[model samples]
Target: MGILSDFFVATPEEALRYANRIEEPDEGDEIEELLDPVQYKRFTDLEITTLWAILEGSDWDVDRHALEYIEIGEDNEAWLNRFPDELTTLLARLEPESQAAVLEAWAGTEELACDPAELQPVVDDLQRLASEAAASEKSVYLWGCL
Candidate 1:
């Protein structure tokens, strides 16, 4: 089994509940975890690389620094919050082709065992979450467990 990541648009209050694993019967809140880690990695790598490419358009290589800005979970588990500003900024700079290229690169590489087609929905879901977070002035978080 590989890692699993949960991506969500959580309000400040909602974030607290998920982080603490606090359960409220009436709240009916459901956190959406991606289907699998292999698929999730596509979103993770592509999002980071695309952001970097937009910021540093010259000679950007995904393999050279894919994990540079990406934070890893220290204890088989970790959470990273992309604040509204961060989400908005990156969202503004991303291009459609850049995202497609990232997906293509992942498919072509031997490093990951994933079908390129499977990653598209994950990408769409992430964008939806990011959009919701930005509109609501909330944060987007990637929670992972191995």
Candidate 2:
């Protein structure tokens, strides 16, 4: 399976704590328990950098605003990273049509290579998540399990 990724909103401290705890294999159940109350959107297989480029209307560049590492599992197969506040802000400001355009662009990326129609719900969830995060003055983070 490809990476299982969740984009969620949380305060910096809470995110750090969650990130740290999520790296522990034994804490999987506890982590699931904690996730019950969190605000999140699942976007499997979409890398954070690719999402950022879609929002910024730019080409994919891994080096562009490198994701801030929160934690990495000992096996190096699982990790957490934060999206920049600027990206969050940009995503929040996009209108529905703009959001659709971004989704179209993202679908066109070689890595995604899928029809934009298939991503409508993903874009909708992202727009809502970004808006909520911005309103609450929280950050968006990626928790990825490879």
Candidate 3:
């Protein structure tokens, strides 16, 4: 069955959105532009750091091709689409907790630095270890989380 057939979202707009994925060929470029010079330098340096982190401890031998996904320029759908033994290798090397921690660290260092606003919480009951200072203010709350 197709996605729309299985899902119960009310509008075509919603269904189409669920079917779509965010394309970020120039996502890094945008990030770089929005950041100040020092921030941009930090961002680039972090990219190098993420590159090495994904490289050195990874389970598989990810080639120059797969590394493009982590990079900021050019469409990388071709390499990203097909199933790779490389992904299996990468996942096999790390536990789910480790994976989440690594992602959290990277996102916190780079993505979080760009937006001082705050991160939308993963779960309300999941317990964030931060003060609720801004949680009372008007801001975005992603509703799709379980």
Candidate 4:
């Protein structure tokens, strides 16, 4: 499933567009470069959702740490909090193949938002999806919300 197979091509554009394309290395690009536990606390449902989609199941996770996004809260416990309720169950109803796809997608999302606690659920979800995909006669690849 080459979902992002074509997503990384650097295209040439007009002078204006090209100028906008010029990217100097920003601090954000290197997630590890930032101070640990964050210097400021900032998060929103939409932002978390977006980060989840981009980071999980990619090379980013192999090299990065999930704790980078976590800010040590007053409780001193770190888990991914504040995600929308709808997202928690979004993968529940899908077929295993779809679930597998969703899990893959979710992992990509998890690359950034994934916490140590959340990893178990993700593994469970993927296992369910794999079993479903295997039992049926087809291998399915789900992407995004059904």
Global lDDT scores for all candidate models = 0.50, 0.68, 0.27, 0.30
Candidate 1 lDDT, 9-36, residue by residue in tens: 6655555455444234333334323212
Across 5-114, the per-residue lDDT of candidate 4 in tens digits comes to 00011112121121222133453244223211121122323333543443343332322322122232343222222222232233233444544454445444533354
Identify the candidate with maximal TM-score: 2
Clashes of each: 0, 0, 0, 9
User: For candidate 3, lDDT tens digit of each residue in 1-146?
Assistant: 11111111112233223223234445534432432111111222223334235434543223432321212134332111111233223423444345455555445554334332222221111112111212322111111100
**What is the alpha-carbon lDDT for the whole of candidate 2?**
0.68
The weakest ten consecutive residues by lDDT in model 4 span 2-11
Worst 10 residues of 3 by lDDT: 137-146
Q: What is the lDDT of residue 5 in candidate 4?
A: 8
RMSD of 4: 17.4
Q: Write the per-residue lDDT of candidate 2 for residues 60-101, one digit (tens) a residue.
A: 676675777775547577677776788778777878767667
**lDDT score, candidate 1, position 139:** 61
TM-score of each: 0.56, 0.77, 0.24, 0.25
Candidate 3 residue pairs in clash (backbone atoms < 3 Å): none
Ranking by TM-score: 2, 1, 4, 3
Alpha-carbon runs more than 4 Å astray in model 2: 20-46
Q: Which model, 3 or 4, shows the larger lDDT?
A: 4
- The candidate with the higher lDDT, 1 or 4, is 1
TM-score of 2: 0.77
